[model samples]
Target: MSSLSEIITSSLQKYNDRPAIWVDDCVYTYGDLSYYINQIRNVLHQQLTSPALKGERICIWAYRSIDAYVGILSGVLSGMPYVPLNPRFPDERNLSIINRVRPKAIIVDKNCEDAASKILPTIKFPLLVFFPSYTQKPKWCSLIKQHQFFSQEELISYPLASISNLEVGSVVNTDSSDMLYILFTSGSTGEPKGVVVSHGNVFSYVNGINTISDCHYDDRYLQHIDLTFDLSAHDMYCSWCSGASLYVTPHNLILFPNRFISEYKINKCMLVPSTAGVIQGHNLLFPNSMPSLKYTFFCGEPLTGSVVNGWQKSAPSSIIYNVYGPTEATIAFTYYKCTGDSVDRCLPIGKPLINQQVIITSSSETAADEIGEILLGGSQVALGYWENEKMTDEKFYSHSGKRWYKTGDLGKLDPNSQDIIFLGRSDRQIKVRGFRVELGEIESVIRKIAKTYFVAVLGDSDSEYENVLGGEGYLNVVALVANSQESKENIIEECKKILPDYMVPSQVIFLKEFPRNSNDKIDYKEITKIYYKNKNSSSISAHNNVI
Candidate 1:
């Protein structure tokens, strides 16, 4: 068993001159990466003297560039847990995260200096900030220089200090059970929670995937997901461990899917369902556009059958895989191969990966025969939420030497095929006229009938219903969002083909785009708020008519 540090060191030795990471036209070979990491390590050693600083929290605010990768690896090599902030994040959001983590230092790219400076004025913590630039020193750079806040050029040009050499120990010390990284959840609902993943947790999950997938040295992987998101974990570590070339597609190119894939010769890629929806909505195909792609992985949100059908039609030869997992369980715990027939049916999340065990537990915490919460027990389970003891105790529990994490998702074991069928969220289940309903079920049915890019179902509160039993009754409300401008009557008529009368949404709202979080997942809470706000202003009534 080797640590992450050992894996990187060995890869550099084996593929010294090989292209290790490609960002735009700038290529960083193994040798170049090794030297840069070493330089960064030396700078860290000079700045941090306290023991806590050895693995203290470090924040990085930068775009997808070579410096971003180097900054991350430098923190790992220096034994510090690092957090990455998307450069596009608003200043307030960025500051909120910074205050929560209270990092010892921050690494900023030159392009983001303006935002960084705005934050620095209000921040009291002593920060060591480094920026990458090729031009002459700017005014802010001179100001910081005068104040001795430290600059990148000074660190890079300074003589290397001679100190006791720190062996490239595991990037994470397994014995310590310490956190290796803190990835914050996309705050779509409210405040984002920081998930603390241990070194052992990451190792077990990555190792399992590496063995099953046979990810090898000859493979060239295209990294499309944001580093802030979990899907990038599979792309980063799997490629790093296998000594494969990692080509990072620029943010601009990612929007133009066909050209991005063809130009990079992307053989393997992972994307969110929203991205797949975009491709399908545009009526794009691979052979005519992105012929180089051989395999693609889709997850993050539910992949509709319609989306899968379009993908298969476009690249029939490409292996389409659907992976599912929460951040609490490393990157992914289950994967399914999507075939033609499988796409027509509800896409099963498939079985658990090697060494991971999953079971459907009822509300009473007893093993159930059918629908229940998805409970996972395996080496891949993370340590717990960071600085959140109450949540840690609730989510993580030990039973007979094994620990299980409650996934908070509803799923059922199929009686015939014995596969797991994902139902909607248990907490999201609502009661309409004493009938239980899952919003996901209604949303899934609506997707098949409409040529929509996205859809979300929420309980409505506008329609009034009279109680026949007691001369008074409570009214049930329902609302939905469709990514098209089709008439409300047309949509309700189409929805009738798949959904039952009670399950069909009472009102349909059309939007050109759905509000999304940083991870590209829909902001359901926000959508519901908007839905109710509109319902309060309109005099909508529920009648026997479809409209």
Candidate 2:
């Protein structure tokens, strides 16, 4: 198969009539999936007449719904890259991404139709709204009079009624290197950058080692992450490649995933470390709680030893893996399976997956374990950031005749076992709820809003000298400002309007002046101590602050 669509199409022959996706207690079969994809392609053909639509981009705004998957896969199958926009995002963030991508089309589910309508004036192109057949007319339908609408019943029965094996191969022609999807992540420059991943990039991930070795056709996979996150690619594609049924968790059930796993009998699971952290917080670590699970993979953030041990006891049958990679690499490219023994409190991110390479540079051969910036080179590496050649050239470089992604992550090699032990980042970037966040970006927003020369945002990590930095809540965005007369509530509210919820600071600390080190730089450590000193009497209430 040249593209992911071909691989999915080939599975239809063998997994026909088998449950391919389970959403909201409803099972959709492989045959139904094929039918929907073909119908979507046909709808595109009828609606989009321009030949330029071949490699155009379509923005999909929705949560986890069956139609959402259809919209994404349909765009890929039709040779267009899909840009997934979370409808829950703040209007400013959404508008920023929309302006950057400049997509040719927009697709929205009922849940996000209203949000889509809000941005319609900003978007001059055509919009396609998809709603379930049984759904009532949306309250915003009359208000959104400027877009095209498709009900599940209207298009499900028309156009290509059946997708034959031959038709599948001919429906859409796409090259292996063609752009598949553009995922916009927080950038250091204050604007989100779209990471352009090709069809081959994700194909290598689904077909590569560790992933294929751990999953099988009969395994039921869980989809818990939002589609906007590239981690969702691993959940959706890996499950589809194995011809396994993908059980999607509703947003409301996100906090209680153990129930979703139990109800769906999910056997193969992929999770971000924060989600695992949340699971640990809930104390649902009873033995056999995840009895059906065979494999559990963690990525997108550091996996602590405590969480691994707790999960191991709960899912005794499952093999827990600590995988690592940046979005620049397709989903992930490294894997480390957890054993009881470890040199530190955190698990080491083991070795590279098949067809991938990792090296720690700027160290001596004797001190092979010396910590340095980690570099990844392999087929799994992405083409580059979309339309930002300057930034792409800076990150993606050629070395030793191979393309390499300069992973800004600092790590070292364990000389004894050759496992890659991840230290903290070399820069100010941090992962919050599995999303890559640039502290500088938040500081940039705060600086613009507060009109201050001194602004610092620190993540919670014990290694940092700041006492305020020692807990999971440290990942909560906090802004420390100097010479800002704006009320904390007022500053946070302004940030909430301009930034996404994830980027918005959970708390703002107003300081008369910042403490400085002997070198004259702002001393964050001392400021952390000062905050705690005043925390008892002057800090804002937790309930009054936005989390």
Candidate 3:
């Protein structure tokens, strides 16, 4: 029932000297966390409220520094939503979010100041740039004349004050409807859609996870996902709620998650199965390599039996669970704990969390089989797409007196086990390297760039280039364009400027004509077969073209 900020403050009071988070070589104690949070809170409250600026939320455009972590908390405590902007994302993509969110103040780390500079002029109103990690003003300060800037030293000199008006408890806002964060995911057309998650939604979701009964102060949790992704919430709250220490894996060690898990002796670890697939591709999933782990959870992508078995053996002492959920339903609301013996290629998603509900939309009550589009319901369901009434109304609807989100994923209930089994997306949406992406989004970009409507982008495993290209054993985004005059090289080159790295197509195949179905629509399955057949006959090494 408590907000994360309140839980964190309680931990600060109780476990003052205990390590709260390990960022690279630095271990930030709860005491250190308190000091930093105070400095940020003081500056934030002073600059935004004192000046009487009209702003909705705080935008955190930061790298994985201690400052970023403290900034997010300070914003939450102040009853303002925090929108995270990743430095890895393209300038165009990040700029779009900046233009849309129009946050009151932006918290930035030293590493992200340059990216911040590019978007400063875009802010239409008065804004504050709180540089917690910078001792001196950044070089880009002079370029942006409208906004006020504060260095780390400047904020430290401010008086100590509480943002929530509570000494050490999380009261985000008097209104339960106040938002905690707004996460943007891939859109069906082209742009990314913001998913507004309220403080109540996050708090309720965290409370629902209490039945797991494994997280504790002594256990060390490893953060393997990016802050931009919702999965990061699980890594943060699950540990903080239990007074457990969270170890933030450095970017250099992110790709080598298995090694990071082993080196740090991470007891509880959660990651996308794609990460495990990468580790397995490098032949690093050796038996007993991670015996210190007590739990291993995978989400964001389908968890295959091979990855499940490989991880179980690697972390012999750990219990592995395959988690499934769209970002709209908090981090995840359903999970299937793995048994050592699993023959199914793709593991079942299992059952709902303590407070969550899952239903097969297309199945009737008296049906012989329970199989259809899976819908998720409970406190975990997100508010809706931010300011997107049309989409919200379309996807979120009242069912049996409770709000439920249309997952778009097809699933079936296992009659014997009564667990939900994933049967892939009913639509063209797919996860590429742990990133939820829309095929039409990529196609839309290509259509606009190439000036043609005959563009089809899909994630295919048998792209006939896996053996040739150094793929990390996951679905690759491939584009099939029909007789477009624009060169494949040029179209993808332009797409890189607008789309994020993950959304960009890795390979482009030009077709003489797209095979049409009965309705003359682009035959996706036929086009894929044609692509594989063409690639097989050519025997061309796709290394030069694979992005």
Candidate 4:
């Protein structure tokens, strides 16, 4: 058996009677999760004619759904790389991903049937569609001729499998170097970049996290992040590695998860700092309100001191940790365990995990306090971008026979403590409510929508909502336009159809002419300055619902 699959099977057997996961009212024990995973795998073997499923890609329609978890494991146990397709994404974005991956099969639940139906026709491959949540054959099956569809009937008919009885020859042949999953992140070059993470990368991460993290069988973890996000992957594996129960907050509840976390007695939660910012903004956190919480993990965005203060007070018993890493390096490599008190607005990201190594270009650990771009290297680092050799070569490089990935984030090591302190991005990309957004992609979409040549999208990272807009760390995408006949409302509506809601501008600013640098390039700094100068000027701005 592959090392990754063995780790999973061993956990299932060891924690047979323990609660493993919860999605809404659906609770699964370790044994139940095992049976469901086996059922899905059996269905796949029987339905798909392809005998060699190893290394094949299986797209999982995921969002805190049972089918998502089961499908992901079925792929892992069956030697298939699982790709997550979030239905909440714009159809265009979802379709683009499908076109790029051309997955061997797609696993989705009843909730995702409508979206699957819409995307099925465009899929050129003979894709197998598994609907473990559907009671019967999908109604859209006959309407779509390109893919094969299976219902829960197939899954129920399959025999259950155990660790010892699992077919070793047919499945579980994944090499440590084999791709475990491909996660798509926003790219500055208009297309989303597919980051390929190997089974070894994930295994190394899970092993490293287990060493320092205090998660245990008694701990109940909150899977508050989206399945589409890389942090969700970390939460799932880390919880399982420790034999802990994972309580998944439905995607609908992630925006405001206080009630669910309190109700479930979730002792551990993985949150983006922006989510904490919004929660604090709404005055939902009272002192010792979440005493049941034992560990509060912050990632995806900067964990500010103010946000940490509020969360620490609310979940006073919880240990707060601020983690840092790009999608290119499997979930995270660096984590800072927060103390009782914080003085800086932005807290330190701290040291790297045991299996990982980081380097700040033009700086060193011996340096008093030198700032530079953070570069990552080690077992946790992902293979590279999928199907894009040019980009792969550009981003990943070798130094002294060790591979290194440029993180693009600007940072420095604290002179005194030597902990890595995160400054900010060195590129156009910014975290809009914890979701990565490329300002250039948003601009490209706007240019296409408005049929205008001159359009620039600036990330308003220091907006009022940097702390809260009743949403996750909300960076308002401000669209600055010079030539466009389309009304701001029309442009906003069109953007919603093509781009993710976060990428859509909360406000549109019309400029007669763009400020240019000496090189005659658009001066984003000057435009941002102009934006702050006219922050409240209605004559130059059109506002959308920020939240």
Top lDDT model: 4
Q: Give the residue spans of candidate 4 off by over 4 A.
A: 46-51, 158-171, 364-367, 461-464, 467-473, 536-547
**Pairs with steric clashes in candidate 3:** 6-170
Candidate 3's TM-score reads 0.93
Model 2 poorest 10 in a row by lDDT: 462-471
Give the per-residue lDDT digits (tens) of candidate 1, residues 433-494: 32334566666655655666477877543233111111111124354555555676777776
For candidate 2, list the clashing residue pairs, or say none: 460-474
lDDT (10s digit) by residue, model 3, range 1-547: 3456567667777888899899958999878887787776676666666323222678888867887788777777777788988888887888888778878888888677777777787776777788887888787787777898888878877666655543555433434467778989999878899998877677776676666647678889998788899999888878877778888989888778788889889999879887787677567899899978988888888877777777788988988888888889899889888977766378888999887899998777577366799999987888899889999999998877677999999988887788888888888888877889888889999998888888888775554324311222245688878757888889888988888788778878776667789999988887766666656766423423222
TM-score rank order:
4, 3, 2, 1
Which scores better on TM-score, 1 or 4? 4
lDDT of 2 by residue, 91-130 (tens): 7777778777877666667677667667765566556555
Worst 10 residues of 3 by lDDT: 464-473
The superposed Cα distance between candidate 4 and the true structure at residue 188, in angstroms, equals: 0.5
Winner on lDDT between 1 and 2 is 2
- Over 312-350, each residue of candidate 4 has an lDDT whose tens digit, in order, gives 888888888898888888898899999768864778899
Q: Is candidate 2 or candidate 3 better by TM-score?
A: 3
